[model samples]
Each structure stands twice: as structure tokens, then as C-alpha cells.
Target: MVAWSVCAKRIALGGSRNWILLLVVFVVYTTWRETFPDAHSLKTITFMAKMKPQGANRPSQSIGHPKIVQDGYQKAILLSYMRGGTTFVGSTFERNKDIFYVFEPEWSLIFQTMNEYQPLQNVDGTFQDPVWIHDADETVERLIQNYLYCNISGIDVTSLRQRFMLEARYTKPLYDCVRMKRNKMANCVKNFTNVCTSKKFRFLKTVRLRVHAIEKLLTNDPSLRIIHMIRDPRGIAVSRQGWQEFYQAKMTFTFGRVCAEMLRDIESVEKLPPEVAKRVLPVLYEEVAENPESMVEHLYKFVQMPYTGYVREYVKNVTHAAKDNTVGFSTQRANSAKTAYSWRAKISWKLSSEIDAICERVYKKVGYLRAKSEQVLRNYNISLRDPHISGSYVDKFRQFRIPP
Candidate 1:
């Protein structure tokens, strides 16, 4: 009787264990499906991103132990030469759910309060870390995601730089550890690079990344893949309106000026040793806008990654898809910076000289022109009337300027 009772208990326990195992498997399967949809499922990638506002915060959630994963990615690094669209793209990448992205070494410049033993609030509102890093899981992730918040408002870059400098001085060993790991990430064919470089993180200790120390990152990260996105300046300058118009921002320089600078930078590259070209690929923005699908596929190929048909489909659908359900309609998505090919219809002889000139210059470069009176498709260079030349709209520019 005693033996039978013991056997019965053992059998029941085994059944319970089996049930628990089944439950664990079900939960994992559900999570995998929820976290990564059927499409675009792969490892993290380094793609060009624009400077946009960060998403609102959600309740704290972590599928993996964020601390361990954070430590892993913190070692990864990203490096890009200026005009590589690092300012906007890097920030976007840093805000990703699956990756850890640190801004340029100049990050110390943007996060001054981080210098204190505790998180202190900077004047324009940034918590600089005196330590190389505060909390592996939380602080670093928050800083990357909130980079844009510092930009949306005025920011103070000076204090952040001080903290960065201080960390370099006192925590030199920790900084070196960070660099060594990042180098490992950068050299690998994957987007994980340890040392990263960019023109600026926007200069407020609260928001900006720094220009100096880029060489240090490069030296530390030798196998960095240089990805350059060369967009025609004509279209880029009017981008004061950006992806959103209500948040219009007149750039520090004109489109032509910036574009000229970009071209000059590329020209100097041709001066580099021939072997250098193998490390870089210049992508024309016009070509990207016209046929983003194939162009991005070409980029993936250049990077030695397989550009699956799904990637082609996704890039194209996103790039060329109508700005909204109102693709033909202009008044949508609040800011309304989307001027399709029909924007010329809104322009008349009465158009202001500045506005008309801006339009003509952009149209010329964007391949849009009123041919004697009709617009038609044109090439990337030698801007002409292009009926299909519907470039991004500069709506807020109209509001900020004297009515033309």
C-alpha cells in the first residue's frame, strides 16, 4: 500500500511538470509572433534614418534580460563620416527596440547631469552621467530614445561636453573597454560597430553629438563600413519643413549651400586612393526617391547582405507609397508638407518672387518645371519641367515667410 501511494504521487507530479512545460512553450511561441511579425524578421540592421521626434514612452517591458542584452550591444559601435546622414539616421537607429545605439563619443557633451554621482537635471533639461554609464539597462536606453526631445526644444551643449571630457579623464579605463567592444561590433559585416562618428548630435549637452574625437572612434574601429547617402542639395535645403511641416525649421544654410557642401565632400573622396572606393558606395537621393526599391536593394547588395524580395517590397512600399490615404489630396497628416506633382497647380504668376524662385530652383533640381506651361519628368541633373516631379512640400515655410 505504501509503495502504491508513492508511485501514484510520482505519476501526478510528472503530469504536472509536463503541463508546465507545454505552457512555457506556448507563451514563447506567442511572444515570438507578437514581437516579430512574419515580415522583416532578421537581426538588427543599420539603415539610414531621418531626424524625427521620438515615440512616446510605454510601460516598461522587456522580453529578454535588458541588462545582459544592453551590455552586449553597448559593446557594438557605429561609425560614419559627416554628411552620411548620421545625425538623423543614427538617432533613429538608437531608438530601436532590439538594438543599443550610442551617439558619437561626443555623447558626453549632450548628457551633463550624467556626470554627477546621481542623475541631475541640466538647464535645458538633460540628465548627464558623470560616470561612463549610469544604469546599463535604463539610463543609456532612455538617453538614445530621448535625443530628439532635446532638439525639439532649445538645448545646452556645453555642459554635456564637460561631462564627456570628465569621463574621458577619470574613467579612461571604462571608456577604453567601451571602445574595444564597439570595435568588435563595427568590424563585423553586421551593423554593429563600437566607435561611431557624425557631424554633430545637435550641440545641446541635452541633445547634441560632438564632431571632435571622431578620429579616435575611427582609429579604434578600423573595419568600419562607410555608407554615404548623397541627396541633391536642391531638394534637401527646402527640407526646413522636414518629415513634418508644423515643426518647420529653417536650416542653418540653404539647400544649394548644403548640397554644394555635400557634392564637394564627395568630390574630395574621388581624390582618395583608388582602393578606398571599395569601402564606400555613393547613393544619389534622386535615384532613391524615384526607385527606392531597387536602389535600397542595390545598397543591401553593396553591404554584402541578401536583399530578399520582402526587403525590396517593404522599402518600395514605404518610400513611394502615398504620403497618406489622401495621396492626391494635400490637406492631411496635420503638417501637410507633402506637395505632390500637382503643387504647380497651386502656383500662379501672382506667386511671390522668393516662393517662385524657391519652387523654380527646387523644380529644376527635382526635375519639375512648368514647360512653357506644362510640367513633365526630367533627369536627376539638368533640372527641367517634370510633371511627375512631386517633391516633399515646405508648408511651414509659407507660414513663416511674408505672403508671396
Candidate 2:
């Protein structure tokens, strides 16, 4: 059976506690079998293995797509955190007329109905419930594979809520894909099958997935290329502070989680072997915004896409133009270049220092200079001693509550 169906079945059956325990053991064993006791991935090799006769829920080896023409279409992912320019980069991919792109399928509203499924906001490095953890892992793996293979149904963005979430963008292409592939039965099944076999460019943009999840994904599908997007932590902290959910938890806990994930993501890519390492391309938001023309061309080369005249035109006219990107649900916002480093002008020295204290190593590693100067620190201290200035700028994270 397809892996997602297996996960759905498990959730539907709602097995007893003991059954859940067994499932955890099975997931752990499978993860270990694929990753441990060896440097390479057995699971990925198995997927690439020659296929047997087709059966229900099994993918056929005879994917009818031609492999010789352009070395087969690519499967790419845009990996980043929320408010960290994911929408901006995903928009770049959307402008590619040939690509069928899905934005944050993992965070689709379809999964909101799953009772035991908790969102990324609640995941803090580990889960207290083992059953949910295992379930989450399997679901993520299935979603990643489904998108790579162009399983449209598995993309899970058909609902009205999902369309609204995407701000009605890309809906025409999404439905056109479904309409074009309808079979004699007037059903969507044939297109799903065709997409499975047909070679085409597919991209999945997500923010909720962690680095460990990405490692497991690579283990299962080595063909997938990752476009890891990073931003200045000061920018992230400043942007997140504007979000309503940022105040749901204390600043220390919320920002600490962000820093931890950022560190893990950077380290994960750094540790990959040469073969797998070549598949990852890290893009900085500031760099992309500052120099879209040069950066976009480099991205094309990195992803092995031709810098066609149309693509160049798109990058120059659409991607680089200043517009109100925050219109509807998008966050790219107006004046892209101006907004790239505007956090420096808005965020206070004390808050920037706190963000730097946690994100110093990652910021420098990613080519971002320190925003907090000694003079800024001195001014901040002088203000802190002044009751009037201190009251004007409330330091919510003054205590620096570190996560356990």
C-alpha cells in the first residue's frame, strides 16, 4: 500500500495503546534499518530497486516518462521557517510556467481534522506522546514522497480552506492539472497515475518540517533536491514578534525554539556526504532580495534549470519588481530590497543582542554581520538606567528564559 494510506488507515483504525506501542517500535526499527549500521540509505535503494508486477496501491516501475530528454524532470523542495521568506522563494518557483508547485502541503488544512495530529508550533524537539511522534513521522514521509512523484491527490490542497490559505494563487494550474488528467470514468485517478509515471518539474514548499525529518526524507528519496532558505535571526525575531502566535508562548521559549531549529538545519546540511551534499542549495533572503538578477541566475544553475529567456524575463520583471507581496496571504511584501535589512532600523539594540546571543554562530556562518554595536549596547544600557526610556521600550525577554 502507498505509505500515506497506511498512515491514514492507522489513524482511522485507532488501535489500542498496545498496538500504538508496537507501531512506535516498528517505526523506530524501520528508521534504524534505513539509516543506522551503514552510511548509506537502504530505504532509498529499495525504492529505486526494480519493481515487481503492479498491485493495488503499488507504484509501477514502468513510469512512462522519457529519461533521456533533459535527464528527467526534477523534484525540489524549499525548506525554511515561517516569516523567513518562504512565500517569497515559493513565489519564484510559481512563476516558472512549467512547474506544478504546492505550497506547504504539510501544513494543509486537511490534516487539521486528525485528532492526534499536533502542529509544528507544539513540537519542541521531542514529543511527550510516542504514538503521535511515530504517526507524525510516517505522515511527513508520505507527504514528501507523494509530492516528489506528483501524486496530485496526495498533495492534499483541494479543500476550500486550502485554497483560501494559498490566497487563490496557483488554483488554476492545480485544477488544470486535475482536469487534464481525468480518465474515461471522469475521475481523478488517471491523472494521479500519469503524474506518478510522467516526468515533470515538481516543487514542495514547507516550513513546518525539521532537519531530522529532512534527513529521513533524503534517505527515502535521494533524487530530491533541497533549497534551504535562511534569514537573519534579527529579522526573524522581529518579524515573529509581529505575529499573534508569537505571544502565545513567552519570547524566550518561542525564539529559543527558532534558534535551535536554525542551528540544527545548518549543521545537518554541513554533515552530508559529497554525493548528497551536492543536492542542497542554501539561499539567504537578504542576498536574494538585494541582488535578485545575479542570485536568481545562480539558483537556476544550481538547480540545473536552463536560464531561458523567459525565465530571465520572469526573474527580472516579476520576481524583482517591488509590489505588495503581503496582499492576501503572501508575506513577501512591498519594496523587497528595502525590506531585506530594514529589521536593523526597527529592532532595538537590546532585542537584537538577545537574538544575537542565541543566533550569533548561525548568523556569522550564513554571512550576516553583527547588528549590535558596542555603542548601541552602551546607549541601551544608558537607556535601561533611565526609567522613562526603559518604560517606552518594554523588554519582554529581559530575563532570557532558556528552554529546558
Candidate 3:
């Protein structure tokens, strides 16, 4: 039988007691606790900047639909947060600007789009005095180039890692800037409410990408379309593991680690306040590929893009790619109508029986499946509750608090 998707989280309140709740992610806890384990994230960040999109969200200019495309732009960054927001709805973009569908390269999108840029803010929540957020595109470009060389180039030396060591190194202006910012951290926090000072914050938050940063970008660039793509948990689990191998890194992608990262996205969606959720259009991998026309129609309206005949044709080819992606996987692809139960097939029957027994009821209640039997669900502590990955998804996750 196919199992359902349950986005498990890693960031618990204190990070231990309820470890069972996060067992799926905790598996990789020792190997990979935080998504990106670097200490650079220690830099303090303000919340306002976190409210916008990391990369520029202006509409595409090259998609042939001139009206929908924003004028005078080049590249744009996309936040494919977790499972659901990953759908390629943005792939059908018929704009002049090129749309690169980024699949969680961490904060690379923010750095790539207008690197070493600066931010400009105006009065009244509307941006006026504007500039690129990255301070120096060239410097960042170099960093990206060498980093990629060390990473994807498959070149010699592992010695190249030494070059990247200098990428984030402190140098006169950059070093002073980092230290200065560190010193005045509290003052910056106080200056956050002021719009003029607020724009400078783009740099602060970009250094650490957050959903709020995406939300802030949305506010500035109202025309950008946001599509949340979702895939089956099993497929994600398998795909991540595979990517880890392809890269051949010491700390490979663990099912638990990816699950922890995915939890953030799921929690973000379920926790969306009334307004933001409306702006976000959720499209499942299965739903979109299975019913392309209908899904595309809704996506166009959501992003305010025009559904031209050209757009429809492009969507067909993309869907074809999606269908082909499911092949060769050890587990069933997430797009099918069936539950992703095949994932359990890989585990020893003993473990599978326990997991299903423990998760079955809660799984079904969250729309993953219908209960095997009324009594079966109760036995698993599964009621009409939503088993989400985010702390936000749980009103009181410690207790079963489903919204009434």
C-alpha cells in the first residue's frame, strides 16, 4: 500500500524532549542538525527584511507576454522552500526575463540576483529610492564561480576549498562592515521600523534567507508570481538521497535532514496568515501534472499572468518532463493518485508495521488518506487532526490542537 506524505520538522522548541515528534528529521540530527551547518548564520537579522522575497520578484519579460512581463530586468530568484512550493508553475512564465527554477541551493538565489547589492526604501511601505541589494556583483560572481568550481566542477585539489575560504573572509570594507554591523546590532534593531533605514536591511537578511524576506520582496515587487509546488514525501526522500550521492559530499543528504528542511515549508504554508496564504497559490506535483490545463489556469490567475496559447503548449512539455521524472525511482513517484506506501516496502516489515501503526490515523486525518478503519485511526492517536511539520502548523503541537 502507498503511504501518505507527512512533512516532519527539525527545529523543535528546545531541540530534544519531543524528539519523537521529529524522529523522521532527527535521524539526520547528529549528521546534520541545522539545514546549513555553517556558523555564518549567527549574524543578527531584523524581521522586516525577512518579510520579502530574497531575489527580485519582478515578472518575466521574455515569456512573449509583454503585458505580464515587467520592463527592464534580467535574472530573478525563486524561493522553492520545501515540498509544496517546488512545483514548476514558474517554468511556464512567458516573460522577457529568464526564470531559473532554483531547488533549494540554500541562500544562493539571494546572492546571485544582483550580488553585493544595496536596498532602497521609500515612505509608506512602498519602495521608492531603490537599488540592487547586493553591494558588489563582481565580487559575489567570483565567489559563486570558484564555489561552483570547487563543488560541481569535479576538479582537483579539493585544494580549491582554500580559495572559497577567502570568499566569505573579512577584508577591509567587507570585514569592517561585518564587525561594524555586529557592534551596532542593537541600534539597527531599533532603526528597523524606519523605512529609509529599512531598505539597508536587505543585505542583512539576504545573508540569511527567510520567508519573511520573500514576503518583503513581494511587497516591493507586487507583480511577481509565487507558486508553491509539492511532491510526495517518498519521492522527496528518495530524490534528496540521490542528489547527495551525485554531489559526492562527505555529509550526504539524509532522509531525516531533508525532512527537517521540508518541515519549514509545510509549517510556513499552514501557518500563513489569511492575507499571505491568499497571495501564495499551492499546486501539488501530482495535481499539476495530472491536470495541467486546470492547474495552469488557476496558476495564471494567481500570478496575474496571461494564459496565452503559447503558455499552454509550454506547460504540456513541462508536464511531460514531470511524468518522466517518476521513472527509475526505487519508490513510487509522488504524482500518482495512490498513497506513497511503496516507501514503506523498503523497510523491514517490523519497522513498517510500527510506523504505520503509529502514524496511520494521524496520516489519514491530514488528508493523506482515509482511515483504514474507525478504530484503527484511534489506535494510532489519529483523529480529525492535521499532522503538519511546522510548529506554526501545530497550535499547541505538544497537545493535539486542531483549529475549530
Per-model TM-score on C-alpha atoms: 0.35, 0.62, 0.39
Give the Cα lDDT of each candidate.
0.34, 0.56, 0.35
State model 1's lDDT. 0.34
Summarize candidate 1's per-residue lDDT along 104-132 as a digit string, tens digits.
Answer: 44343233333223223343436433223
Q: Which residue ranges in model 2 land beyond 4 Å of their true spot?
A: 1-71, 109-131, 153-161, 164-199, 219-222, 243-249, 318-325, 328-335, 374-404
Order the candidates by TM-score, highest first — what do you get? 2, 3, 1
lDDT, model 1, position 295: 50
Residue-by-residue lDDT tens digits, candidate 2, 1-404: 38756765676566587467657767876754432222124454355334331342333222233232233667778888877977766766667756666677666422432423222221122222211333555556655666567554443323212332342244433444433435222244354446445536777778887656656556445557777778777777767766554353575567778878888887787677756766777666776776776776766556655556775666677544567554444544445676766666666777777777776666545655554484654342222122222311112111121111
Give the per-residue Cα lDDT of candidate 3 at 378.
34
Q: What TM-score quantifies how close candidate 2 is to the native fold?
A: 0.62
Clashes of 1: 36
Q: Which should have the higher lDDT, number 1 or number 2?
A: 2
